[model samples]
Target: MPFTIKCPLDNLYGMHVFSRLPLHEAKVRYLVEEKVPSMHAMIELRSGEKVRIHFVHPAPPSPTENDESTERDAELVIVARSVADSDEPVIVTGDLNDVAWSPTTRLFRKISGLLDPRVGRGFYSTFHADYRLLRWPLDHLFHSHHFTLTSITRLPSIGSDHFPLLTRVVFAPSQGQDQEPLRPDGDDRSWAQDIAQSKNANKQDVP
Candidate 1:
């Protein structure tokens, strides 16, 4: 089957998604051309079901990167708003550049109303592929309640700074319809609004 690599044009640090399924409405978002871009699209499964997917890799909170994570938080909130608005079964996976248990990531889950499989489960850290002692779960996958996790694992290193993340989810709306997404509180809503409404796009999305 043919596959598509959705990434930022001429940028090495942008987010990338490789999918064999038929993808439509593919678009890439980024605040900085030198930073990882966020890519989103719709994929048609074999059963004719459509799933919305987003891939993100915001700049890390280093002195040379996002500094205090302002852009990172903004980008995440933007994506969260998009996901929350989506009516289709959504799956967002990416190297978020933030820990899974961080406040930003928590807000992302709440704002998006997505379910995290990592809860109750141990932290499946993936960063520092070479140094096991300094690893963190910077990569994550959050999805709608229309599915259930079959398995999620941190795979062996693939020659990158972060270990590969492998996830499998089964679509069974009947089984997951009862699952409730994390509700954002008043404070969470206010912060999410502040980020989403105040942040302006520094770069246009890719076609």
Candidate 2:
């Protein structure tokens, strides 16, 4: 299965790219050239698959004359719903411009219920390799718990400031097919009051 997808970050350097291979089994391809809105797509091997995709970005606060400007890229969210009785796999890969440890990214991982293969796996710097201390891992591949991580690798820079990441993930039969709780229910009113008190305390602490 082959299809074309427009790049969300048009004219930006170091976006993801794809090519066909002859040795592969079944494959669904994505093309990221001159695309828009930073697409998120899922291809079902057959029918009755639950795959959800979302492209996201955080808009910066309004800039002032004294502030520096920056461009924020979109974060792709791909959800692969399990087949009813089949053991086929689902995979999602992309360049998420956000940092791995950012709160927004964490929330995304939680909401999407996707497990990052890079976690517990060693960190490999991908962005700003030239700057030793300032580099960070920006690209990511996240999968559901049903998927087992074979390998995750950071590749050499392709003439771009950010190097690419290649990951091999496989879907395995679930030992126990059960959904985990998303989050515990909390009192919104109490939480708001707590936040307000904390803010006032911080104000008192400030010089």
Best by lDDT: 1
- What residue runs in model 1 are displaced by over 4 Å at the alpha carbon? 8-12, 31-35, 201-207
All candidates: TM-score: 0.90, 0.56
Pairs clashing within candidate 1: 15-37
Off by over 4 Å in 2: 1-3, 8-10, 13-36, 44-92, 175-207
Residues forming the 10-long window of minimal summed lDDT in candidate 1: 198-207
- Work out how many backbone clashes candidate 1 has: 1
What's model 1's lDDT at 179?
A: 78
Candidate 1, residue 189: the lDDT equals 80
lDDT of 1 by residue, 1-207 (tens): 475755555544645567778988887656433456777778888899998887777777786755577777877887787677766799888888899878999999998899998888889999889996898889899989989999998888789998888989998888998877778999998887777556563222322
